[model samples]
Target: MSKPYFDPDFDNLLERINGPTCRVCIDNESMEDCTVVKVDSVNKQGLLLEVVQVLTELNLTISKSYISSDAGWFMDVFHVKDEHGNKLTDQKLINYIQQGIGTTRETPSSAKAKTYTNKVFRPERNGYTTIEMSGTDRPGLFSEISAALAYLHCNIVEAHAWSHNDRLACVAYITDQSADTPIDDPGRLADIEEHLTMVLRATTAPSTSGNQANQQEVKTAGFLQGSEDQGTMTNVERRLHQLMLSVRDFDGPSGPPNLPAVTPTGSEESDEEGRRTVVMIESCDEKGYSIVSIDCRDRPRLMFDTVCTLTDMQYVIFHASISSGGGYAFQEYFIRHLDGRALSTESEKERVIKCLEAAIERRVCEGVRVELCADNRAGLLSDITRVLRENGLTVVRADVATQGEKAVNALYVKDISGNEVDMEFVESMKREMGPIVLHVRNETNGRSSLPPRSSRFSLGDMLKSQIDRFNSLTAL
Candidate 1:
């Protein structure tokens, strides 16, 4: 087993000053398909997440990556490309990446991390109030919340909504409608909180059989936050992951009601469309490391999701390799607990596997992609969502943003029964919302576009080859 080169208990200024920091080098000619980015830095918990987060936030695609951290240093190489699958040729973007990825410091230890006293809303210095909520997944939920905010004269500047395992987590950035600034009045903030809380706790419409459980109000919670947990503030997407985990969204019922939830390898058949994400964990006893292997459909921001979960779970990734092709992603990680122990128990392994799966599937939005670009106005979000609800469409995920005078929103919607959206209804929606305002971006069949499992190349073989390469590096 390898060990850290630095002493954890050391306090000498020279030793600290001479310790390793971060260095980033980008190579555009390493390969024709992608740019190669290599980072050498001091090994610290959460460092990997920070690097991945930067790349993800920059909207770059990580086609492949190699990570190794032993002897107190992080050495990683990422093969990345732009959203259009082209090499990052922009010098400005490359420079920004070097600066962004090279400056991440170790997150403070838990004892030094900030603790929150107010669990409701905290006004950010940028003149916006951030509100967070998690609750049971149901149709029209976002509409209800937005309606309440509109009633309170709050304008949602930006918002992200994600649903997984029959649960929902949302982060909305809002400002006072008239003032165009953060709502500083405690009374007004309280009213906002109360109204949202009631909306979240409202019961779902009863089914034909009138099940009392479905009729009962869901147990939900909301909190206002100025920033994410731990020491440094993170992006809103990562904050959503933290919020969902805190609410135990991973432990809830799998998928939407009447939809098959993805499970482990032995029984993941429920999600026939995407073939559920597969996560496996086993101990590399000789190296005192726990190896996590995952195979799932390739999607944007996938690396960020998995790495974020591992960091939050306090797992230190010592080595990892990621590759994607043929519409699927395969990743392998050598990790140890923050306490420097391999995952030792069956329950622990199971929990990590489940959480990792949850992380990956959380953003795997199922439904049709509809994009709206129109002039921004009051009650716009509420009206759009209400129209969806009335048309028998349910939103699985949404991204709302306001840029200057335009409202650019993306909504992934499906039939209320968790089926593909009807093109006819979508057309009607376009006419009602204005044909030029709302457009049907894409219709997803809710299945992997790739061929069947038997027809595709073997994932096990791909994983084994990657593992072999990773092992060779570690051995050297």
Candidate 2:
């Protein structure tokens, strides 16, 4: 965990700023057969998603919601109920919900910290490098893993992760971003392994030792402080920063607001009619990968959805540049098959384009919706869809996106028996899917109960077993 670049005073300012706070007050009167949960908190990125996750795990159906954010504060009111279409009376459950969404304040540290183990190992693989880790689960675990990968310059192509009973396992297929190949240098691979091991160990380790606890607290405080700073930035400033990072010539017509001469990178593609998105793939022999360029009208989670689809389909992204301007996003990804071959046939290219297009379109549709955010693991999409299918939920549309270690999935569905999604069905689905999402979220957030001995296994084999167990547990 390298300290984020920031002014010396920034940490002090963050310490003074209040983080998010949550309160769950059960509505006793007014709304019949419903409980209203009101949340007032300082706004941060992904706040809504986190709230939804907590409610879903509690088996509460949100029949209606009023959400608003102003300046830096957010107030959300959710009309919720149990499966029997009755108001909730469980004080225990209400307490659990409050605890789940409660904010933890960060205190800045006076001393610098060492963050890595610096040990690395090279696993034997031909085209891809496999990194697998298992440990006691904790909050912010996935974010730490993602940071480690980014620090090592490793590009994740595919991933499968799961957490069960306070234990977590993650497997990722990666390639060196600069070289577009499996990490071959023993020294570099050693460093990658060492750093990630340290991150996982630190998160999993108990804080009984006062010295270690202090160190961990300081590290987390710094990380949260950086998050606070980013959350305070205006949308325009954030977008402008993204634009500057993606475009080489800031003077072009496509530059940020008021820079009329800076030309936008995807303006030509935007000129076309009717198509909200354009996907182009071309072979790059020298690089041994295909170049994928996507120009589209930007919307929420566009990049995450695109990357999720690619990873799910087993395509490997070596290098990528993602930028948004005005109202559109321009993206370029250097990709290859898992077997290290370029996409060759027209059919293959069309399939790739169609998948990306469909994923983008799904994000804009509405139906009987369920939202999930968790640590991204390999075969996670399969497991989620399997649960829905088993519960007779017919999926009409689906959207999956990942930011850092968190995968957010939205599914639009209907009952297979041609009935509207009633309370019974919603409860059933929640009961089945709640633990899966909660476990991943908890593990990624660096919170866990205890590690199970059976949790240790290879990534592929472990995924299969875990899915099988879930099926057995949720089998109708």
Candidate 3:
């Protein structure tokens, strides 16, 4: 869609800079003075402004921010002393900030590193063509390779990442936020791909050597969005980013197909036209769990594409959550509302599941795994902690898991010695804690709720407990 442009001057630094101190930093390092209050997707300058604008919008305060630019490579440094500066714990957020600017989630992923994947559209950005890059994960690889994108002003918007027990993959989406500049400049993408080749090179020994092991593939795809869809695009883009991260986080491609809720009764949607119908999945999170995994594979983009395909095929979406593999994914979509279209023919359901199954197959690793069971018992959490302590680990964040009359305690922790933990230890601890199951991990990346750093307890649970105590005192 063609978007009109306006060049607005960013003379209001005071408002953005009005936070508490002049010196702001992250991980204790001080940032140089850098404050921008506006963004222009048309001109390259506006891209910088958008970076600043997104940080500000997320309520992230960084004082004395410093930026380095050489050729087309760019590096931005800032400090965030608190969570509000970065609410959601997202790998994408970290990657976004590392490159330039991005949004923050209300829920934070408490980790030294976070990685996610997403899909985005820039209707008609000017000056800078939006560019993104992603591939297998490597240490310090991003810093060395992103210089190419920075040199060409490929402001990073989002990055998605995930690795199996042995392999890794990543994707980064960047849009030129410069006003008065085109959003699809060839120089931008070319610079990015060149640097991408450099960034993706393996300096270390190969792990997946044979046919699947010795090589790596990095491909790029792009599409311009429509103007009428801009309003929806923001939601779509943000969700896409979240979905990408969720997939990588969950390692969706490694999991099995989620059980289909609709059983085939040998009934065909009476439509002789043979149009495909969408899979209609409706169920509370899996039994014994509040959240389950979805095979996101291509991240939420796969989910989005599937949803779009269903819509085009005349299906309707009632509710959806692309974050989980919901490949173990969940959606209450069907063709019930189609214009007299018989939606759930036996073949249609089979075909829809097949389509999603294919999506999971191509994207999911044949290796990811997940397991769940009830966890509500006395001293369950304490036992979990005891086991962790015995295993030479420390609890980083533990949650109070209760269902009805039972209580189950869950924790997110890391090995203090950085030792590779045995699955048996985790399972044994769960058994001791009476969590109802031994272990649960996404089949692909082995990404589980236990490993990642989490801060979910910061939300109202404590306050609610305190309120409960006060009410009990009143009753006494």
Candidate 4:
């Protein structure tokens, strides 16, 4: 028996390694793209084990590799292709790789360089973005649209909504929620628009299904509202909207727009850049109501930076915006890009607003009650962390408060041992900080489900079956 092999930085293990020579070809090409890479190690088995991933990804025939006729010089040669136009052969493979890598310019076929360049932006300094929604009204228009947006997760910065003549038009700065969600896919946006239309129709004017109550909920749904009470969407509009959203190619058939080819400052592309989007934002609103005020040059940059950060951190973009002011305090004008994908779920969407509103409260008035009071000496973040650590709890995320000499910290903590530090620990940390405050908790962290789980098979049965198979095979 051979000693097992091991790769320090990767998953390859030496003990179970097999040689590169395969007498039979194993090909399964239903889904994953076929790409393969072969390796040469201390032995043929070790090298073959290392190349498993390359084999799966490249989808190559392993039996046809360049294997040494003599056992002394062990080598596994894969037929992988490189930009240098050389096949992975026994002799020139290493030299071919040297030419393939460490170059200043990348090749067109380099999947590593494929990019999805998206951006999530708040309102910008001088640019403008506008969203005009015109449709028949229905009950739950506002709530459904707002709720759908709440579901899709978006924020309204500067909005002017009204029912004019007989139609509804809604416009606002959508970049308020975080630039992680983009309204780029015409299909998705259209679906959302259709849903918005349905939501609006349902809210503005119910289809005789609603008398008045659900209809009222529709009116305040979002900005898009028609005075009529309607719900549910007609087939034609829904189909058309869905068709429009089927856009996948980021760069259109005409190629990138003829703007000066300059990368935006502070924008980061992925290692594999698969797609990219550009947006311009502009708007105005009540300064005190949100941090969304246009103070100077950096203000727009901050908004831009926030969007960029969202896109870079997640895959989303702020497509466009346009705005002017209304609210209160320091008058403002701004527009923002609403990146839809940023908030992964409807609940997350609510949290997005929750955070934004908190930011807005602080912006409107510095000393406004943002959250619960903090404990000082015991309440300090470090002390609380110490308590959590001492109790085998790992702090997931934390928010702290400070006023004059006193402080308070709220922590979201969990333990690797599957046991959580209780309210006692939280109170203890609070006491260590300064004044002891009551601890409120959500006990949902890491507690295993007590409810019966549904699975295809039980572990005990699975183990027995495996043992039976092994016994039968050994006897054979």
**Highest TM-score model number:** 1
- Across residues 292-378, which tens digit of lDDT does each residue of candidate 1 receive? 999888898999989888887878889999999988899999999878999999988888888887888788776678888766766
- Tens digit per residue, CA lDDT, model 4, 277-381: 222222224321111222111111122222222222232221212121221112121212233222334444333332222222111110101122432322123
Task: Tell me the tens digit of each residue's lDDT in model 2 across 20-72.
Answer: 24444556586876788877666544454455545654556555555555455
What TM-score should be assigned to candidate 4?
0.19
Question: Whole-model lDDT, candidate 1?
Answer: 0.72
Backbone N/Cα/C clashes per model: 2, 27, 71, 96
Error of 4 at 84 (Å): 62
Which runs in model 1 stand beyond 4 Å of their true positions? Answer: 1-20, 106-115, 205-234, 252-260, 264-266, 269-276, 431-436, 446-476
Evaluation by lDDT, superior candidate among 3 and 4: 3
- List the lowest-lDDT window of 10 residues for candidate 3: 104-113
Off by over 4 Å in 4: 1-379, 418-434, 443-476
TM-score of 1: 0.81
How would the candidate models be sorted by lDDT, starting from the highest? 1, 2, 3, 4
Global CA lDDT computed for model 3:
0.35
